[model samples]
Target: MRKKSVIAALILATSILIPTHVSAATPKAGIACSKAGLTRTTATKKFTCRKSGKKLIWDKGVALPQATIAVPSPTPSVPTTNADLIYVAKDQRILRHLTASDGCANPNAATAHLQVLIGQNWINVKNINFGWAVTFNVCPPEQLGKKDSLAWVEVYMDPGTTYRWVYTGEVNISNRNAQGNGISGSTTVPLPRPVIDPHPVEGGYGITWENIASRVQDISAAAYTDAQATIARNARAPTAADNFTTYLSPGAQSIDPNIQDSITLLKRTFTLYAAFPHPSKVFFVGTTLDEKDQTYAKIDTLSPGNPFIKNSFDNMYGINPNLPAGSVFTNSKCNGSDALRNTFTWPDLKAAGAILTSFCPTDNPQIHVEAHHGAAHEYAHLIQIQIYNYHNLRAAQPCWMTEGEAEWAQTAVSPDFSSYLSLQHLHPYYLTTLGTDYSVPTNTVWSASELTDYFANANKIATCGATPQYALAYSAGAAAVEALVAIGGSEAPFALDQRMANGESLDQAFNAVFHIDWAKAVLILSDVVAQKMTHVNQSDALTYQTRP
Candidate 1:
């Protein structure tokens, strides 16, 4: 099977083994259908939903209502506007879990873009500092055989973006009754005054912008963990305008722990980078693969006016010397990645947002899943990219610099991470490059050829007198960054990285941060590896295997 297919199958198989656990505040109690105050989605539709916070939801269609007090033609006037988005109620869609009752599974989160049909044009809505909550349907006793369910309604705005819904005060109906989804879900919005006049929607005469895909999340979602709370306390929380979803298979939700760990690790990394205030923040991570794929592809283009240009060689190690310049070359070095490029530009847009894995323990049976290691490593790339505006530029720091720093992030993101590496059996790939040494020590002298393998392109490595290059970009590469840290202190690598990202050449950055040329920096790291961190301690084999 294809790699993506295999992953999809793995997700399905794992989910089948895990069970769904629902946290319904009120299992049977519900509000009456008539009293739910669901605004009709259309003049003829039956299933309906509505916004609970505002007094008057906008009439279904593109045109919103704006009460403009008459003023001189050119004079500025304060105009009152109410355009709460509205949807239809679900009377019988319960069979498919389409209504607010679907909150039974997960009700506090959503992952989607707003699609508004204005007049005859379908517009993609962007830039909203808002989020949603659920509303309960209080079905009267006469609604036989129907169980109480909740539909997502109500929005909270202007709150800061937080895992917990606490920033903005209530702007919607309360659901203190356990029979409902929750007391009230909130959004943490740092709203920029909207460009309200930019895209005015004229009420549709006949067009439709109907049906909302509820982003209902679990009750515990947004409730900050102590770690996340600390981020808030420290004033280092992520502030990008984005939404995220970890789509678990039916069984994976209960059976897989690695996915959850990775998700946590991903979020934690976000906080760290936000503290740096990363430059290239993404738009969103959708609820489904398709959504992510599309978003990724859109974001991948460096700019609308000047799309990035790349080239793919036609071999396992497609390192053709004859390949043209002014384009990216791929030897399929799939391990190292970040928020932008990967080993290969994703051929499948549907698999867009994943920081994918080429190592499958089941296939190799030696490599293990280190969730935080991979997550943080990928995130570090993002930080690196922002520091450099890398996607727009052509030349990059050599593999040793890029991969080595990313590898360092694994150990730096969490203390527990190094411990995990310590227990992992060196995957065969690494065993080849590191030469049977187990522990990642600071002193290990890599040969001139090995350095070439890590820093040189495939064509150069193939010509260099080395065997099985093994992409020595991990341990060896990391050693490169660590060597910088050793000489200049912990902050040196990032300082250099920032300079490089800000249009300074590699030589300039090295000169600026370390008072040395790139040639000297390379040799210094090689010496550090040789003199310090050479042999691996025997204690790290088991950690990698059991980490997931």
Candidate 2:
């Protein structure tokens, strides 16, 4: 989802909360000392400031003095490696700053003093977390040090672009020596390296606008071929991989191997990279289609390569364009194109047609059942059916259960079902059904708070909450299921199996597992729901929506 940057402490936005007093706000003649500063080796370079009540009082215009500390042998020779780019000695630390900018406040403002390493080996700068650049024979020996005493670079982007610069200033190296004597030993010297772009490339990634055009034809063709094959499988009896591939290739977009594996793909145009089979490929899936039959390209959920991708996908797929952009669509009914039509299980079309016409005369008077579902609803049905599969349909499950579960699962693939959260807009008939008699009881009704609590606790582990309910039901409904499972105590083992066997309602499955009658189970479920509601005020539900 959202790009985030972590600088030691979660330092967020720069406060404009500064005093607006005419003289007090004026910039000093020399170096400025802010709460944000660089880490230095010598203590003498430490920033000396005090808080006058709520305001910060500083030695204005005075360059906080500094000295340099040299590393021992193996002083980390100049990284001559040929990477796509090289950071000036100090650029390594600056790079760290850039990573933090992913979520930090106005990064440009935070890194006003920062500089980047440019061009060849510009010595006299500090470098950390080096990488190997094959062409130039340059690289860091390892990844970023989680916590290192040695100062690390922190890079920040210029508010609106990929261009990033470094933050350079002195830090306090002394332990607890508060007096000036304890700080006198530390020094602030010049950075050890320079930030340099080997290619001096304008855009960060080597790929250019021209490169994008060159690859567009191939990418589009590949997506088309893949979609066709997937649809062919859907028309017949498809395997899990086939189903998964279809989901991944929505909107007919091909994927990049590296991108597929990167957790960031969720934010990218791809539909289900993280949920897909392969973990390493840089995958790219097409977004929901537009009325014009085009796919929107979102780079990492937040990074929209082409801004119009949203409107186009939303219009064609009937998705809520205004919903939180990064949240996955869990209720979408349609697929990009008409792929489900081929997913008919029957082999002989004539025989199947007769069977369909005779059995579903009211639904298929013209024998065109496929068109009714279309791509959206067909995919929706598939999501619900896939969980249980035809093989598990022995027990006569209730229609409400089936419909609700299917409706829930549809949202997993496309979160549009959450539109139901707008309870006020619900049709009069639907609202009546949402009340206690048909829904959960007054004591156990799935309220927003209870749902939030269940999700908060359930996300603590994977195996503990494997039922589709945790994913599809969401909010209140999810909480009800969570409560049912908790009280019935059969949630883990019986959920999936029960749903498959007889299409059991979540409540029915719980009673079966726990060997309790439906009435008793409902009472226990109510108790659990009430308990969850008590702590609902303290739980954090949205955390899982955008973690990492």
Quantify all predictions' global Cα lDDT against the true fold.
0.35, 0.27
Model 2 misplacement above 4 A:
1-239, 246-285, 291-383, 386-473, 484-511, 531-548
Candidate 1 structure quality by residue, lDDT tens digits, 406-457: 7755554454533534522212133222122223334233354455434544
**Residue 331 shift from truth in candidate 1, angstroms:** 16
TM-score per candidate: 0.37, 0.24
Q: How far is 117's C-alpha from truth in model 2 (Å)?
A: 83
Off by over 4 Å in 1: 1-245, 275-369, 390-394, 417-470, 486-491, 531-533, 537-548
> In candidate 2, what are the lDDT values of residues 1-548, reduced to their tens digit?
13345442244332333333322344442333344232222233333344445654443333456556676776555423233443343212122211111111222222222223233332122333321111100111122121111212323212222222222222222332223211112122212221111111121222222232222212212222222232333343322332222123332222122212212212211232112111111222323223223322232242233233243234223353322222233123432222111122322211110000001112222222222212222333333333333222211222223333333222222222222121111011111111111232234224444434443433222111222333323333333432322222211222433332332333444444545554444444334334433333333322211111
lDDT for model 2: 0.27
Model 2, 146: alpha-carbon shift in Å?
67
Candidate 1 lowest-lDDT run of ten: 211-220
